[model samples]
Target: MVAFAVEHRPEFSALRARLDEARRRATVAQRSLIPAPTLYFGARGERAVIDPREVRPNAAGQVESLGSDHRSILLAADVSLALPVFDRAQAARARADVDALTVQENLSIEARRVRAEVGAARASVAATRSSYERWRAIGGAVEEATVLARRGYESGQVGIIDSVIILERIARGRIAQNRSRAEYWRARTALGRAVGVIQ
Candidate 1:
């Protein structure tokens, strides 16, 4: 989802516009490359154009006239197909240009956003890791203090307030541990989203 939304950012509209323009230009180029099929023949009269092979001998053994004019012979010559030529050069060029532009725009936006997200996630992980380590280190000290304070209270060497303070320290350590765990999970989730994997 992160990857998909990042790709759909509003700036992609400009890329889409550029693609459309390129397509339009390609259409014009394509039209221009369409070879006119009329280069070999010209039409003049009611007589249909005839192929040389269609000329037949008359009952009197004479070649038939194609038309009233002797100079009106339609010459058949080699005509080249144009689509393949255009596709190999001009159309292919247009396609490559559009592809490069599209990749630039899309990847630029995606990379910037994913990098920022990754940075934030990494920072969160670091902070949570530090907190977790600090809390774990203090946990043993807090428990020892709590045990000593309880013993001192029973022996009348420490007051109820002292015990309460020690218990509060232990409670605070536990709370910090829980908070750190939550933060770690949150950071992991953010990192997952940043990397485009939705676990």
Candidate 2:
């Protein structure tokens, strides 16, 4: 059991890293849209003053030295300089789009990786299964030979040593077939898990 080492698979690790980075970028892009409050101030008019010459009316009602007709007034105003709040909704929608795309891309990559891993695992399982089947066939033939050899020895037609050798070889083939079968089943399980479609 060489630890299987599936956890350290490089392709899976790279996919996870890419997903995390996409999420982080989407988050940053979304947070950049909040508007900060701002204030705008400016002088609007000139100061007004009383005119002494306009205090007295003209004696002839037609002669006036000076008249105060156009006057200036000092005006101060404060206004909150805010971008139209409703416009922010559009930016928010864009942010949502970015986030959505990020999620979609990550899921897409994940699905692809899962499918690829499952395919590879399934291939391994198939090969191992074929080996197991081949070994099983060989084991059966060897077992039959061992049986014949044992009967021959009992009947004094063969030596005990040949019987023992045949039995050992048959056992060895059986062991090999058992090992292959075990590996095939283990690979099947791995492929199921990778595909997220356990059977």
- The list of candidate 2 runs beyond 4 A from truth reads 1-82, 85-95
Query: Each candidate's lDDT (Cα)?
Result: 0.68, 0.67
Q: Write the residue-wise lDDT of candidate 1 on 101-159 in tens digits.
A: 77667768656776687778778888887887787787788778778878898999888
Model 2 Cα displacement at 99 (Å)? 2.2
* Tens-digit lDDT string for candidate 2 (1-199): 1112234445445655665665665566556665655668666777546566675666676645365656666677767675555355456556656666766676576566666776788788889889988887787687788789788989998888877887788778778878998998888888766654453
Candidate 2 accuracy as TM-score: 0.52
Q: Estimate each model's TM-score.
A: 0.49, 0.52
Given candidate 2, what's the lDDT at residue 176?
81
Stretch of 10 with least lDDT, candidate 2: 1-10
**Residue 16 lDDT in candidate 2:** 59
* Model 1: colliding residue pairs: none
Residue 131's lDDT in candidate 1: 80
Kindly report which residue pairs in candidate 2 clash with one another: none
